[model samples]
Target chain A: MTAQSDQTTANADRIIISVDAMGGDNGPSAVVAGIAKSADKNPQVGFILHGPEETLRPLVDKRDVLSGRVRYCDTPDVVSMEDKPSHVMRNGKGTSMWSALESVRNGEAQGAVSCGNTGALMALSVIRLRKLPGVNRPAIAILFPSTNPQNFNVMLDVGADIRADARDLLQYALMGASYARNGLNLKRPRIGLLNVGTEEHKGRSELKEAHGLIAQFTDQADFDFVGFVEGSDISGNKADVIVTDGFTGNVAIKTGEGTASLIGALLRQAFEYSILSRLASVLAISSLDRLKKRIDPRRVNGGVFLGLNGTVVKSHGSADATGVSAAVKLAFKLAQSGFAERLAARVASTVELTQDAVELADPVPEHQKEGQA
Target chain B: MTAQSDQTTANADRIIISVDAMGGDNGPSAVVAGIAKSADKNPQVGFILHGPEETLRPLVDKRDVLSGRVRYCDTPDVVSMEDKPSHVMRNGKGTSMWSALESVRNGEAQGAVSCGNTGALMALSVIRLRKLPGVNRPAIAILFPSTNPQNFNVMLDVGADIRADARDLLQYALMGASYARNGLNLKRPRIGLLNVGTEEHKGRSELKEAHGLIAQFTDQADFDFVGFVEGSDISGNKADVIVTDGFTGNVAIKTGEGTASLIGALLRQAFEYSILSRLASVLAISSLDRLKKRIDPRRVNGGVFLGLNGTVVKSHGSADATGVSAAVKLAFKLAQSGFAERLAARVASTVELTQDAVELADPVPEHQKEGQA
Candidate 1:
């Protein structure tokens, strides 16, 4: 084991991650395999796996690395992909997803990981862990593969809530910057507001207002505001963190993923076109593998729920062992760094800054001023 | 010559497409070369090249295919990439972009092609050619590389006007369907309203209203409404034509382009990683070439400005010879199909249908009905 893992293992308080084991497409086996992989990598990490014990016990027993590192929370139900968030919120108490999050709520785990329905997960999280102080709406932040030195850029509001006013956007910038600081190890992440164009006059009124709000809080928030960034800059090195309303952010990321998938499909067809190219593919396997790894969605397979009281990493519903492991790794890292507490502190200061800026922008009349009285 | 080219060549009056020759990254040389390529392929097409004659004449003389097919309209001023649209609208009388649109305005050319600033081109087109009757706001439509049998899907309002209401979206659905009919030769295109999710309950209020408005007009609009589509559907076969607000559309396309470019860059790096990969790249040249050609933005380099009095194809400002040629070809095709007239007719009918639908929905209380008197 590495010295870092040894140090963590030697510590009295080992980090435990809450994981929903039944909701993923591959079921509890893949989730168990994923946790085993995480256990092999980090000796200090433990899992509070939630699922039907009969189904998950056998899978966990098969993995040697997970022998004693896991604790079970038996639950009968699973949140299917099609379950409505509202319906699930009311009736999801017996589900594995709810049990998984309960561990985090009860302080049994530092963070939670789930591959359940995103809507249900968000709803359950809001009801259980609750939103951070002064946060109007929580945002789902994702790591986009980019040209930055860090190899990824943080983008927020990828669809927690579709509508974000100027205040919400400002909070996203604050939370996203804090995410970059902890998640990507950036000292002072540059925050860019996503817009149709980079020009100040472009985009809607809310965006313009958000621009001013985010810019005003830069100094106190401890981040650089790169003004407005175009969609192209999401994967470019212009900013370390990109902020936008959930509606636009969700669409932009999905569009980017679709385009990448299309290119990959096209490339596969091209290589299989001829016998000579087939032979060439063998020789180019390592290089192609490197390329695939560089842009693999599986490697960065976690969408973090930001602005919440606790950290929750939502793995892709269709994630395999590799993807699930990546999510676990992310959840473990956030837990180790105490990201949620830091984020809460960052957001709390941001809310205070916003109040100050608002007062400054719209000064109270001298006759009605509270201090004057 | 092919039978198609011979048929066009034998026509009494050849189609003249106005070409703005000064603003592309490659300058007049690329524009002249591009038109020359178009001239060689389409015997029915001629060009009224707009720029300084001294600069363009030599370039045109060098291409034998362009020998009498090109007509120069000397305009001394050039619209630079950085020129503001508002400023250009007022002071761009003598510029190449303005002169190019003027040809279309005066019926000297059937359509116009510009490799100038998008804002300037859009601004000038609005001023010179004007909006088609009943078009609240004009939209810029582009063909995206997709998995459809046609290998392209039409997406619109990509930076034409950022704000699109339910009515504007409905109009876009009409105009986009009409474009697909002429441009892609789809008899009945499937129109999808771009949103954050495919569910009826998702997205903003305007999208929900647009869904209803578009569904009501499907039969009249001569298209199939696919309800709401997520950003992934842009390149998927779920819809043939995707309609969205300019802000979202613009951002989505740019994000797609950026992702594609990033993959291409990563592929290049992978090939150069080692000796084995280098040898493999040489052997796989044909395969790589095929893949590159399939996704090359240059091959699909035109954004058609719909809902205008005349068709205007906006080539990328950074477009090279090949890219410019694609724009000219699109302009010629649109001109040949009388796309402007057909689109205007479609929009006019859509407006009438919308009015009828509105009246039906809000029947002025029975006592105050229009026919009461």
Candidate 2:
């Protein structure tokens, strides 16, 4: 049995995931349908759905694949997309989002999935799941489609917090590397610090410092530290993991998505431009469909919250049934692999390694060092 | 005659643009061919080419379209891609980049186009032409293909300077709006402040301040302020001008390009996947070509240096003859419209309006304000 299953009350044969069933644009029905789709494909998966019982029970009953494997944690209140994180944290006891995270907090579920407001979800996750021992700030890590052999690259701190100091960036590198290892099944993922340029002297001073710190721990952490990478390298094969401050990462992620969406729209316009083009589009339907499937944003739907005590996956607020299913599948895989426990251990060991390195370099007693300053 | 022609030494009927014919990846031959193409299409355009006489004379002479319309300013030195901006500024007097800018400074050309290193070129432009009065920092504004009727959106501070405070961002809005007005022929452009979210309380403190500052000047500037816009709106029809700090703008620009390039690559892969797809590719060649042209980066190849005393267009360093022609065409259009003079007047008037508004709001003397602080 995995470390996560040891703590959970769930059956040894099944992995239980706590899911918030409300607040998505498509409503509870889409969430139910998504979980049902996941359950039908993965026999080892079960769910504890959180929402109003009357609303969710009927939806769950409609899916035969979800029978007997689903449990309900009914909470009437739902977090809206416009809700403030602070307000949600203060008066969230009866909310479905809060109740969903309760299952993970109490060790009843190994992982959690939510399609609520990202800020509120992140706030609640931090309060309930807590931070890993060595983590300063938690980050949102998402997988981006790329030309790598694995076909995806992991990028972190997409919008967890806007500010990251040198130490925070170093932790991101470590956390991002661990996520790639368990999430993408890479043995030694290459970690890259995102910058304006590849040159060592370019970018903010904190990045330069983070570069040295990340390189120092690469050998001990079992990840290759590729120096600095530019924005173009985000979708390239140069690095398996890209780390940056949340502010820059958030802008980069949104810009990339916007560009892709625009290209897709323009391509449709192109196929319908002329009669000959329309005929060609009809003949090329299967070819175009294959291309569409390859770059489909729905297939890569979850932003996993890293540096937390327990795993939580945040689905897009506007996610459809397919997008929610993708998130659920990702949560299940991470749970089965005991990603949370592995990440905790990885961070704890790195902190210890850093302290030892600091002591060796400075050659000063910890107590006496304070007086020197 | 236009305002640009009234100041230039060349014939009033011809708009002369200084062409830096060195430092690009393809060398002076490509630059000469690009100018030749532009000259053939535009009978009223002339060139003052800057490069080594021995190398550039033959290239220019080979193009019959450029005969009797090209003047050479022989400069033996060239700036390489690896040269630092500071180093270039101190020792780059003999380089083609400096000579090209000199032509603009001396009123021999209305604008200058260069495919040299961006840093060195920007540095040289600033040193030779200087910044417009009341403009704290200059910016590099590029045109992005968008869903607007004009087919492009203007984004500023792509990498002129990394940090933009409230005042700097406000200036970006003014400069970007002016660029849209003249470059895209928009009567009253809609400007948006780029942030992580559209909410008023969402981004960094500077963005919030910039939002307020920009809104105050919209009526006086003859543009509609669209409040906060996210990265997705960079290519959306919500705004024609997007303004942000150079750091965020640079990342957003590169991310958009990288994503577009990735999609293009994936499309090629999809069409080559099977026998039926290959047949469809042949049939849909024209349709696909239309799509390619619509979104082609080469077609929109210039990043105009805004808030400068003179017009300077920076082409992509790896640009080909077609790309170079596109940059030259953009420079010619901006010169014909006398964009630099119009932008300077717009900024000057806004600065005066701001001082008047501040005086009216506070009712305090500028000399006595320091004592109050």
Candidate 3:
């Protein structure tokens, strides 16, 4: 842990992270195993596991580390991986995924962590917790592997929705900056709007409008607005938070992940191609191991959904026990530092400027203004 | 050279590729140096160097491989990297960029290759060569390093225009598939539309429309339209051609290039970190060399401008001699196989479909229809 996290822990109250234990590809076993790992290390952490008592109790009981650290909620239904978001919304009332989020909504849990269908989890989070005041759209923020002082940089709107207007993009910059400040522990997280070019004249008109809007909030939001950043700057230290419409962000993240996976596969093939290369692989095993660990997607396993009354961290569905543990740890950290409340406060304060932003670029119709308000 | 290129040369005529020998980052020297390299190995390939005759003459005289085989066009004007496309179009006559394309326009050269500003090159290529009869907008096509049989996959609209409607996307599919068939020598190239997800119901609305349109063209274009593909397929061999709006493609390609560069930088740092690692590096030199060569950006150093009557391959402005040589080779291959005429022919065959696509998508405005026609 960094000194900032240590300082945060010293002042904050005990944090409980609710766990959705049923729908992950690895099932309840991985969730229970993850809870045990978290419980052993963080005494101030507690879990409210949501699943069928019959299925979860046996797994929780197998780990002595989870004893007295967990409280189970008997939710029998499970949202399958193939379930549509609309279907899950209508039928998911008694499911573990719904129960876990409801715990946060009802103030029973500080934050929720789920390894479920992304669309389902996002839909449930929005419907359960509702958007924060002044936030027209909630965004899903994730940490990309980086070469900065911080090992990760925050990127947001990774498919919460396919669209973002000038107003939504500005909101993302603020929300992403808040996440970077509290989660990554940057004092003034630098915010960059993702565009095709760093040049001022390039890209869509919305981006140019978003650029000016984000710039105005730098002094107010207590972060640096680092103009436009090209896609290359996402992994570099040039920006702490890279903001974009969910459509572009989603494609960029998937492309980076896909490229990394392809490179790993190619490296393996190269190593096994010849006896001399195989010998080299054996000799350079330590350095090669370091490289692999540095780029392993599993290490950066959680995507935090921001711009809501309550926070939710979506772990990868196919995550192993270690990945689930990482997500839980992230949720615990965000909860302990009172991130959800502070983020809500931040948005509420700057919201009038958000309205000002809309007026500046696009005027609201006099009749429609009341409805939007 | 791959067996494919060897075959292309065997059955093809002597090809002449025009070269814009000024305004690149390294100036005329690098351009001349690059032409020398391409001429030495490819016997049937020739060059028409365009620039100020006095400055370019000395450099061509330095290379014995270029004697008697070079054609010079005395154009004193040069397009600086800073010049805007609009500025170039109005005042760019006599510039090397214009002369290079003009050479192709007049049948003095089969294709044009330039390392000038991309926007300017694209603009000049459009104004001088004009769009192919059926092309609504010309796209900048690039070859991404991939694990395909050809070691590359073609991606288009990497920033020719920020906007692409359903009709424009359909044109890209037809144009890209044709390029893949001729340039990559794919009998039936598989085309994928870049999107946020592979699901039938995911992504923006135009994507759904574009998907349907491209599927309709698979039979007519003699290619396989492989529906939607996520970012992962960009580097994988899942599709031979990946198509998207210029905004998304530009960011994605930059992201991929930046990520690959970042990984390369990190790998070097890891290898040099410790004495044991340095020893391992010595032993693993062969494998590392192969890996380095495989991923080098210079090796895949050309972006082909499609949808124009003539071909113009844009090389990186700061590219060294090897990179420039790669661009020349690409231009030579396209020239040898009559790619420009073939691509124009392909789009001409689909000209009726192009009109149908626009009408199906959005009824043409009466005033604009005549101008568009």
Candidate 4:
């Protein structure tokens, strides 16, 4: 194995996660409970719970499993979900989520995990830790819950880059492929451009341009480019990684969330309407539960904001203890993999090639270069 | 009652629905089942099963309930979902779906029903019927399934009018309100702009402009405009009608759909893990079924394409018999309410006022007027 691979394996074995204890709807209690439970199961991993010292002390002291493994960082302020993204980025200096992120940026912790405001986390990351050298924008990549566990779909720019160009899309595809490789341990990640249809000439002008760019990357053997994927393909897991602008990705994820909840509720109602049907539902309860587990949001709460300088995992704002636990696990997995550094290195190398292509396509005049000097 | 309203109401009461028998995944079986079930319940309402005589004739004849109510329109061609929207609109002359839509356009039927390609339906509707005066684009308005049964949310431009301005959003809000009142029988629907945040000064510049226009309408009592709404508020039942450009709306709906399915599958997985859990799942199966019924896609499959000269209902592309039946029922309700005429009149009034406002704000110069002449 290569030295980098050895380091990754070592890091994976000794993962330390910085958890925002004061984040989410239920606060430190749920965070503490989840972290305590998780730490007990994973002896190789450690935790640094960031929150108000007073609040975290009692919770830590009460649990033997947590006290030894989990430490605290004194952060007084808690960034509420309702706070404006700009305001939080400016004023959240001492916030637990901010402090947790700082730990990751400073390399005190391998990864930062938070169930706080999404916009705030995104803005703070951009301002504080900064983007990877060649990354214009970082994308939030989520694995849509899938029936085939082996075929989880990675949807990028899920409320990160609202107005992304073809270059941004190319970066998303590259980053998503890297994520799938490291995070999901896929040998060859199939990259797909999420469009209105699967046709080569489908979608708006922007998507068409993006499709061409992705095709170019695939032709060069960068990743397994699977071409275009439609809205319906998301559920079917047609691609390992699906790329789109944040606006579309955000709405698509939300729509999927709403629809799944609606269907679950519909089935519940149908069983209630008649006694005979209710009994039949009782008989088929195992099958239903099996299906539910395959699509649980709580089980898959952590979504990594890829292309950042450091690993930053975002948990749902409405996440419970179960969701919080999953986020921590995801963070541990990401940190262990050394995925951020690998991605940054890959992007840095590609940037040089892309620059050369750009220069070749439209060479800058000698006079313009002299003027700059 | 006004002459138009009285005539429409009478027609609605005696409305004959022409269903595309060859449309949808389940084919004629589901269509026939839905029609038979509907005809048995609604004695006055009739149906025309449009498809190849061989395919549909036997299905209709087999059901006693469909004996007199269901007739046939001989159309051989079937527009597959995979077909191009433009091609289906231009060349699908004898397609069952096209024929069904034509039945409504030619006034041979009060309304048409189809569970075919949404793109094809939109294209055909725009090309064949022509848009209502002052309407730049026709929009699809879906009543999103909210948690509260009493307060369903209406989302407009759910895949139409890709590039929309403030004027277009205002028009959609007006049309959505009309649909809510007419089709849903909501007295006065509260309109909301689907925005990133609820703050007065949030979202893109276009949203700010649209917000101002909606506020103006609310002040004038045109409809109950309820300010802005975030993604989370969509299922919270805060607003009766949510208006957005089709691009965002389509993405949002699809995301919600994907997520809902994801969650449902997860829940299923959870119940099937172990024997003890399986027993617990069996005990809770009734509750689960009740929940499922509340979120049934079939119950909320039909979405009205508002701002047209006539009522056009788009069924879910993957809709079964119940979904098609709901679409037919929705069309009948809309036709009965005379919503199109009222909507057109309202929009015309608003357009006239807007023109006057523009003239007052920046009057055309003499040179410009002469150039126009």
Candidate number of the best TM-score: 2
lDDT of 1 by residue, A1-373 (tens): 0011212343346688889998888888888888898889888888888888889888988888887677778888999987889999999999999988888888878899999888899999999999988999999999999999999999999989888988889899999999999999999999999998888978899999888888898889899999999999999999999999888999999999899889888888989999999998888899899999999999999999998889999998888889999999999999889899999988887787787665575567777677755
Q: Pull out the clashing pairs in model 3.
A: none
lDDT (10s digit) by residue, model 2, range B79-134: 99889899999999899999999999988889999999888898898898999988
Give Cα distance to truth, residue B11, candidate 3, Å: 19
Residue B361 lDDT in model 4? 42
A1-373 in candidate 2: lDDT tens per residue? 0112222344456888889999898899989988988998988998888989889889988888887778888788999988888999999888889988898888878889998898899999999888988788999999988888998899999998988987788899899999999999999999999987787867788888888788888889999999999888889899999999998998888888888888888888988888888887887888888877877878889999999989899998888888899999999999989899899999998887766554554468767879866
Of 1 and 3, the candidate ahead on TM-score is 1
TM-score of chain B of each: 0.93, 0.93, 0.92, 0.90
Off by over 4 Å in 3: A1-14, A361-373, B1-13, B354-373
i-RMS, every candidate? 0.9, 1.0, 1.1, 4.8
* Model 2 alpha-carbon drift over 4 Å, by segment: A1-12, A355-373, B1-12, B355-373
lDDT of each: 0.88, 0.87, 0.86, 0.76
Model 1 chain A lowest lDDT segment of ten: A1-10
Please tell me the TM-score of chain A for candidate 4.
Answer: 0.91
Query: TM-score of A-chain in each prediction?
Result: 0.93, 0.93, 0.93, 0.91
What's each prediction's TM-score? 0.93, 0.94, 0.92, 0.83
Go through the candidates in order and give the clash count of each. 0, 0, 0, 67
Query: lDDT tens string, model 1, B14-105?
Result: 89888999988889988888888888888888888888888988898888888767777888899998788999999998898999998888
